[model samples]
Target: MSVTETTVSSPLPPGKYYFSGNEALAEGAIAAGCNYYAGYPITPSSEIMERLAARFAGLEGRVFIQMEDELASICSVIGAVWAGAKGMTATSGPGFSLMQEAIGYAALTETPLVLADIQRAGPGTGQATKVASGDLMQAKWGSHGDYQPIALCPWSVQEMYELTITAFNLAETYRVPVFLLGEEAVGHLQERLDIPAANRVARRHYQPGAPPFGHPDPAGVPSMPAFGQGEKLLVTGSTHDEYGFRRTDDPAAHARLVARLNDKILQHRDRIVSTRSYRLEDAEIAIVAYGFTARSAWLAVDELRRAGKKAGLLRLRTIWPFAAAEIAALGSSVRQIFVPVPPADRRPDHLPGNHHPGGTGAVAWPATWKNTCARAPTAPRSVPAAATAS
Candidate 1:
């Protein structure tokens, strides 16, 4: 059967189906082969648990656990994954903080798991009800070491559904933790989500009896063996070689293993990174943003274009690995690249510098022609523009 046909859902008899973002995520997970969920209830994310619990109730081999806390939640999910089950968890900012250590462990061990952080304002419990994109940096580097995570940022309810499936595919493909980074507004927003048919869903499976970390493809992503596949698997957080054995004292083993784990995602960035471009072809000014910030930036771009100004939009869908090449190519055509600087907490600081001739402009909302151009370190000079009313 064709790949699309294999995962495509049979057409539903002409009827209407309405779902909230949380429900759509649950449906997406079920379609993506997720059989386990371990998470604690937290604002803006608790509905995901509720929906999954109800959906998985009568399904055999499916497990849902309400752990005592977020840390335990992630820890349990990791154990579930090791037991040969596809596992996941959902949380908001505060709970996400508690789960950081466990997330780091999953990263170190090259565990395939999906984590959804429906973010809220906070360093520690800032604003639970308000919307914010402050977790962008954390999603990429929340864990304490030099590890890479495939992160998907969804702006709307439909994207929330689509990205959940993409997150699982990335997790299984890279054999590493994947994150769905959403803020309060997007996570809680209610909208119509197009649920793809089962056959359209992509499922990742291991070669029967394959070694846990054995690479069957040119990329270092190994064919992941399930826990009960009769393989004597030894999984650990310590630096290990391809054989999945602990080799903490071996410098070469450490370097090789770490590089492979990180490179597996970085090497395939072209296939992984996705963005939405609007009026970018010949525009002189482009606004680069993601999540809710992108929504506003797109609106502003539309308004600017309507006013005969040369404006376009570059909306990011995959936040990690930074999409540097694509951004650089887009920057080459634009005069000024305006990036909506989200609230401090959600900003992606490691994003590569813009290579445009006019440099990068960081714009805060409701301001017009108020550009702050920071030249690259090797560039000739910096240009600052006085704030003008929008």
Candidate 2:
């Protein structure tokens, strides 16, 4: 149901309402002080744009534009961020495919914005309505270069609201484009949404007379200056100095810029990455899952526990900037780590979960997954690994 209907039908206060994941995401963005939005309508994620357009219509200083295409949509979002507005855009797989280059630009320029890839199945628009986590690795590496990705996955409609807000916070904190890696199902699923007060979300601090991309602090994140702020900003996609001066030929400048881009997220991985555990204190076998697939993994883990098996779940709330330390801890505690991956042909070349080793004796289950632990014959296939997740 739409937010307009909730007032008359359900009598909900501003903090509480019933809605779909897509609607909740739009609401979260507004609550996070996102005043700018630009996107092309696409499956699953299009609802975000539609809802935001309606919301922005009645609010001042809020802008929502329906761009001509996906590429233009992402470019506009990054431009909006540089223009001093917290901006976002949403799309499905094919549209997401078009936004990769712009996302890379945002990464190189250290622009703070959010992109929601409410993923559908695809290599090239293969399935418009199908739900899949096929974009997991793409969210990490699709843009290319050595940029660090901060991607979040939401398994349920409620988390859809929560993580959308979290995505904005992380993007602003790191001055990078953070991704909300949701799935088709989550976008359409309906549930109760508990929205925190708008003042609770933090905004990025702007410092005048400071270098835009210069890391004067040890945190690796630099102070951001919005456009027209009289900070003399010169953001670009090429290698540049903190003063926004280009130095593409200077190896040291290139190296420093790239390292800062990577380190800002990696060095703060512990703070950026988040994962949820279920009965994992003493689990013998752990299932690694995220997005829609995680729902089944939780159910299977519950069933395994009922069957007297020490099975647990490690659901990835943050898919990128991989939760290395958390995975390492799971490695020493669990004997086997089973990932409910998509069919072999549909899998991404790399994932944020690939960092762990030694203890995780993981196997990729096929597309024909059931609501239970691995089948009797499901083992030792695709990208061979030794031991378990360590």
Predicted model with the maximum lDDT: 2
Off by over 4 Å in 2: 1-16, 197-199, 343-368, 371-386
Error at 281, model 2, angstroms: 1.8
TM-score of each: 0.85, 0.89
lDDT of each: 0.73, 0.78
The TM-score that candidate 2 achieves is 0.89
lDDT by residue (49-164, candidate 2, tens digit) is 99999988877799999999999999988888888898999998899889999989999998889999998877887788877778877888888788887899998888987788
- How well does model 1 score by local distance difference test? 0.73
Worst 10-residue lDDT window for candidate 1 reads 381-390
Q: Top TM-score: which candidate number? A: 2
